[model samples]
Target: MIRSYEKTDLEEMVRIWYEASVIAHFFIPASFWASQKSTMKEKYLPLAENFIFEEEGQISGFISLVGEHVCALFIAPEMQGRGIGRALLEHAKTLKGKLSLKVYKENERAFHFYKKCGFVAASEEVDEYTGCVQILMEWEQVR
Candidate 1:
């Protein structure tokens, strides 16, 4: 089931973010995600609108949006490829009408996934923190 995030879901959601980030961004050191944990918990997640996918009473994945821009979408590494991310994106589209996001250029899985989900790469820029090129992608609602 998909629903708004509850405060009780914070810990699991943070864990999912950290784990998925480490796995998807293999070029980055695990310590980076570890260091971001507090910010994700104390600042980012709290400031963003979040939705989660729960299955069998456990949290499997989640998506976070700051206005029309999706800042984060992650699935527990073991639970990926099961459509949870697509479901989350679809849900976001229904609410926002159009959506945009940036993905690390090196993360091809995510870049292709977004493309398959109907997003087009709009531009690219370097990420100041990681010095990696990032691709900006956008999806517009079909009329």
Candidate 2:
């Protein structure tokens, strides 16, 4: 089941974000992700409109949107491939109708997933923080 995020889900959301980020962005050091946990919990999660995917009373994935930008989407490593991330993304689309996001160019799985979900890559930019190439992707709801 998918629903709006509650304050109580903050910790679980951060944990999934940390775990999935490490696995998906293995090219980056794990310490980088670990250091961002507090920021995800206190800064990003609180600032964005968050949606969570819960089953059996536990949240396994979530998506965070800042205006039209998809700031984050993450599924726990063990819970991926079950369509939870897709479901959270679809729910987000219903809220905003159009979306834009950046994906690390090296994360092929996510780049292709966004493509499969109808996002078109618009351009690439270098992320100054990590020195990785990021693809800018956008999606518009069909009229």
Candidate 3:
């Protein structure tokens, strides 16, 4: 089941973000993700619209959006490949007529996933946050 995020889900969401980011973005030091936990919990998350996927009463994954941008999407490392990420992304598309997101260029799994979901690479640029080459991708519903 997917639903809007509640304040109580914040901790689990942050944990998923930290763990998933550290593992998925292996090019970045784990310390970077670890250090950003508090920021993700206290600052970034509060500023975005968040949706969580719950299965068997436990949170499995989440997606965060800031305006039309997909700021974050993370599935618990242990719970990946179960369509949770795609579900969360589809939810985002329903809410926003058009969507955009940035993903590290080295994260091929995510890049291909986004492509399969109808997002096209709009550009490539260095991400200011992590100083990594990233792809800016966008998706728009056919009308």
Candidate 4:
């Protein structure tokens, strides 16, 4: 049920973003979510492409990428731990090049999830707006 994103998916995407951001705040702040929307749309969305996972015709999760760099991946809280995230990461792997992304250092679940999906921690840096340390990860396929 993976497909390209459409404008109609915005509301659901926003909801998912909010939910994920709240979960992210154990290491940051909720207000960073509000502050980042314009930048996310103007900077991130244009550089990124999105894919939605549908079940029985409803979107249950999504992953967005900027070229080979994943900008976001989220599954509804109720829908998590059911392999949706892994499936999306596996789908990303089938794309034609190396893939990369950043995850909050304190979000251990996400850090481990990406690791399990074959990404390796390549770097770390502080996020300017949220002041949270983030780890940059990458996965590359040998030719």
Please name the candidate that would achieve the greatest TM-score relative to the true structure.
1
Worst window of 10 by summed lDDT in candidate 2: 88-97
Q: Quote each prediction's TM-score.
A: 0.98, 0.97, 0.97, 0.90
| lDDT of the structure predicted as candidate 4 | 0.83
**Which has the higher lDDT value, candidate number 1 or candidate number 4?**
1
Q: What is the C-alpha lDDT of each candidate?
A: 0.96, 0.93, 0.95, 0.83
2 or 4, which is superior by TM-score?
Answer: 2
Give the alpha carbon lDDT tens digit for every residue of 25-123 in model 2: 999999999998998889989999988899999898999999999999999999999998889888988888899999999999999999999999999
Better of 1 and 3 by TM-score: 1
Best by lDDT: 1
Per-residue lDDT tens digits for candidate 4, residues 1-143, read 88888878877776777787787556567776878776765666556788888899888888998788898998887788889888888888888479999998999989998898888999999988677899999999878
Q: What lDDT does candidate 2 reach at residue 134?
A: 98
For residue 91, what is the lDDT in candidate 1?
96
- The residue-by-residue lDDT of candidate 1 on 77-121, one tens digit each, is 999999999999999999998999999999999999999999999
Candidate 3 residue spans exceeding 4 A from truth: none
State residue 49's C-alpha deviation in candidate 4, in Å.
0.7
Q: After TM-score superposition, what is the CA distance of residue 117 in candidate 3 from its true location, in Å?
A: 0.3
